[model samples]
Target: MKINVKLFATFRIGRGKIVYLDYYEGMTVKNIIDELGIKKEEIAIIIVGPHDGTPEKMLTFKVEPNMTVHLFPPVAGG
Candidate 1:
């Protein structure tokens, strides 16, 4: 299955903003984080779903084909 991945904030320090990955049928958010070399603790938010659909937010959620995943690292603002 092919999914669109968007890395945000600190997650984009080294990697570009977007990447297309060929994931397996039952791949989870953990796999995407590992593949991007980002620690699970580094992720602050995970949005997964179709482009115009309401995203399902959860790290343990199973990623389906053609889903759009947006990964956000911890943010700090004051």
Candidate 2:
């Protein structure tokens, strides 16, 4: 399965803004993050296809083929 992953904020340091990953069956959002070497605690929000929600729920989400995954880091303000 081909999955499109979009990284936001600090998450795009070494990794590019958009990444294409070839994943296997039953791959969860957390699996993708781990593959990219990103820590779960560093992710604040996750959007999988049409479903968007907290990291807690999204991390465990099983991704489908050709689905786009958006990951955002915590935002800091003055």
How close is each model in CA RMSD to the real structure? 3.8, 0.9
TM-score, candidate number 2: 0.93
The per-model lDDT (C-alpha) reads 0.75, 0.91
Which regions of candidate 1 deviate over 4 angstroms?
A: 50-57
lDDT of 2 by residue, 16-54 (tens): 999999978999999999999998898888999789987
lDDT of 1 by residue, 1-78 (tens): 687898887677778889889979888877877787877666666777542222234756788887888987667888
* lDDT score, candidate 2: 0.91
Regions of candidate 2 where Cα sits further than 4 Å from its true position = none
Best by lDDT: 2
Model 1 residue 3 CA deviation (Å) reads 1.2
Judging by TM-score against the true structure, name the best candidate: 2
